[model samples]
Target: MEQLTTSLDVMFILLGAILVLFMHAGFAFLEVGTVQHKNQVNALVKIMTDLGVSTVAYFFIGYGVAYGVFLGFNLDGQLTQAMTEKSGYELVKFFFLMTFAAAIPAIVSGGIAERARFYPVLLATFLTVAFIYPFFEGMAWNGNLGMQSWLETSYGAPFHDFAGSIVVHAVGGWIALAAIIVLGSRTGRYDSNGNMRHVYPPSSIPFLALGAWILSVGWFGFNVMSAQAIEGIQGLVAMNSLMAMVGGIIAATFVGDKDPGFIHNGPLAGLVAICAGSDVVSPLGALVIGLVAGALFVKAFTWTQKNLKIDDVLGVWPLHGLCGVWGAIAVGIFGSTALGGLGGVSMMSQILGTLAGVAVALIGGFLVYILVDKLMGLRMSDEDQYEGADLSIHKIHANPPKEEF
Candidate 1:
């Protein structure tokens, strides 16, 4: 029975890891569809490379920092124990979590697309995955540095993020925002007087929609399999994810004035918002959260582009950062028994935790980008930007012309 149970657990988490790993393709396609025609190849290449870099960083440093397991030493001993008594559960768990860690750079890639130098961005990916992201991840998830203890002592409960709303999505979003600011607008994106000179539309709405659909489907595994064990799985998490996704779609369609980008991104906004409280919130509360997140993405994305001049190509700050914060906070409001939820959360704790995550992300993001900028520069030159990253950096276009015979 013990052997059977262990095998089942390993298989469950391994499947989840594979599903989340596939979401990287979603991230790549989303960016590819959103970026300009000439930059699409770079977008695809950047996400894949960032994943490779993030995996190495996490395997060496990030996982140990967050969970205190050094895989380097005693590798044979660890593997022997893992395969025999533990059924390799720990190894598969690392795979599952590494996918989450890698998502940080994938998110940042969308924001910094079009003009970022390739190697510098990879360097930034290593720094954040190896140090910055895991630091907060340790605090929130692993109770490292006594942060979770302090929160529970003062606020009555530890910060309740069933999944990584603040930890992964918000951190990625804020980091992307900082990188975008440091890299500045893509060449001709703005004019001398700070007026918007050009509007860059999505290169392929179909691809964008496809990416969103892939993410939405894989999110079931992202949220439900977060239980990490077969015994801990809950149908509630799956149902809530579904409700939130539907709500986001309806709200975005109504609020975005029929814009396809807004419509496609709506479900993602909702999923981001519901990640924190998916296990605790009622389906109705999840729906409300999704609705708010969807509308918020549309409004915030528009406002930031027009007024703040952030120039985030995919509105990552809105979809991930802002919606992620809302998701964490909504746990306090909607996860209460008073609101037909499972309860055991407080708004104060959520606020403090969310603020801590944002602070870490912003400071760490700026620091990484600044250091990389000083060391090797962050952005491509104007000439490179005008030529687009596809040809300038990768030496290939997304769509090549036929040869003239």
Candidate 2:
């Protein structure tokens, strides 16, 4: 029986890891499709760099900080054996965490696209995934000081994020925000008159659509695979994820001015919004949350661009950060034992906890980005911006123009 449990846990974790891994391709295509032709290769480079950095950093330190050091489970006490006895599981956890590490920085690329220096972005990715993110993941999920106190004193159940709304998506969003502030807008994203210019991505609509579908598929593992134990409502998590995505698609497609972009972004928003409570929310609740998330995402993106003067190259802030916040709070509002038989801390308390998580993420992200900007210079030169990052940085030409003949 014990072996069976262990096998199931490993299988679920592996499945989730694979799902999250696929999101890389999703991000690659999505980002490349959303940016200008001049910046497409730069976007691809960032994604690929993030993949390498995530794998290495998470294995070395991030995994331990997130699930090992912070969990406070002494193998010496539990197994009466040396630390070597636990190295295998620890390694597995590290691989799992690499996906998350990769994801946060991938979010940042969209915010700083077209002008950010490649090496600087790489440095920022390392710092974020290795140190900045691990701190929050430790506190929130690893039963460290924050989760322990919340669970013991406030009756919270270990800061129940079935996947990672606040942990991964929101953290990534906050980092992206900071990077944008430091890196500034693209060369012509905002004009001398302080009016924002619309810079269309160089890729086709089909690319964005395909990327969205890939993300939707990957999200099943991102949410359900976190169940870790088959008995721990893995099926419920999967169901909620599916229902919310559908609801998000429906709302995104028809809710706005019938914009296809909004429709395309809906599933991503829905996935982010439902991430926090995927294991606990009922299918109906997930649907409602997804719909709200989809609508809110469209509104937030439009508002941020039109009113706030904040330019997100691929709309990462709306789809991930803002929607992630909504999903985190949704746990507080709809997380009831009776609703789906998966309850954690009280809804109100979870709300506070979610806010606290956001606070930590935002503050940490800001500080890290500021330091990176100061130390290494985050953005490229004006000449580089005009010439395009692909040519200036990589000395590569844009995709050859189609031949009319």
Candidate 3:
């Protein structure tokens, strides 16, 4: 019986890992569909760069920092028994955590798409995933300073993030915010009169729709993998994630005054919002959280663009930051054991832990962005910006003519 249970756990973990991997493709298509034609290649480049850098960083330093040494080893000794388990299941856990580290910094590239220097962006990706991001992951997800340890020692129940609202999404969103602030808006995004111009993307809407669908499917793994121990919990997480996506779509359509783009963004917001507490909340609660997240994302996107004058090319802040906050807080509101074997958290502890996670991510991300910007001059020259990164950086054109018959 024990052997069967162990095999099931390993299978679920692997399944979740596969799901998260698909999200990379989802992001690639989604960003490609949102940006202008001149910057389509640039958007794709950013996604590719993020993935490439993340792969190296996560394997070497990131895994050690997030799951192995920083999280498990203290001044005295290793923190968790799981870290020393030496079993195949333990190895799976390490790999699963590495994916989360890789995904967090992937958010930044989308926000700073067109004008960022490729080298500096690559550098930033390395620093974020390898160092800055893992620092917080160690604090929030690993066993030592992680929510579980904090809750076990300071409070009672663990800081109830079923998946990664604060750990992954918020970390990525805050880093993206910092990158945008340092890199500045894309060229001509702001006119001399200070009004923001509309920079439309060149890709087809079908691509964006396809990416969103893929990401929605990927989210099931993201939520379910976090359970790690429970069987029924994985099912619950998958169901909650789906319901939230549906709710987000419905809420975005109605709340955004029927803007199709806003409606389309709803599914992502819902997924982000439900991620933190998917295991704890009931399906109805997931729906409510998803609906609210969708509405908030629409408003937040508009406000960031029109009001705050922040040029988030792919609406990273709304999808990750604000919705992440909603997901974290939802743990307190809906994570009642009575609902379905979920979190039974106190309001104060949940709020405090969530805030702590946010603060660490924001501060660390901001510092890294500022350092990279000052040292490397993050943005390209005005000439390069007008010329487009594909031609200026890669020296390639989208539709080249044939050599002749």
Best by TM-score: 1
Off by over 4 Å in 1: 73-80
Error of 2 at 188 (Å): 1.9
- Of candidate 3, the 10-residue stretch with the lowest lDDT total is 70-79
lDDT of 1 by residue, 322-402 (tens): 999999999999999999999889889999999999999999999999999999999899999999999999899899998
Which candidate leads the pack in lDDT?
1
Better of 1 and 2 by lDDT: 1
The CA lDDT of each predicted structure is 0.92, 0.78, 0.78
Count the clashes in each prediction: 0, 3, 2
Model 2: how far residue 32 lies from native, Å: 0.7
TM-score head-to-head 1 vs 3, winner: 1
Model 1: clashing residue pairs? none
True-structure lDDT of candidate 1: 0.92
Over 4 Å off, model 3? 1-4, 69-87, 146-156, 229-233, 337-343, 401-405
In the order shown, the candidates' Cα RMSDs to the true structure are 1.2, 3.5, 3.5
Q: What are the per-residue Cα lDDT tens digits for candidate 3 across 1-405?
A: 887888788777877787887887888778777766666677777777787788778766776777664333332443354445534676576567766777776677778877888888888888888888887777677664656666656766666676889889977887788778877888788887768775565355876777788888888888877877646555778888899999999999999987766777799999999988887799999999999999999889878887778889889977898899888888888887765536667556677777877787778778887888888878989999888887888887655568897
Ranking 2 against 3 by TM-score, winner: 2
Question: How many backbone collisions does model 2 have?
Answer: 3
Show the colliding residue pairs in model 3. Answer: 35-201, 36-201
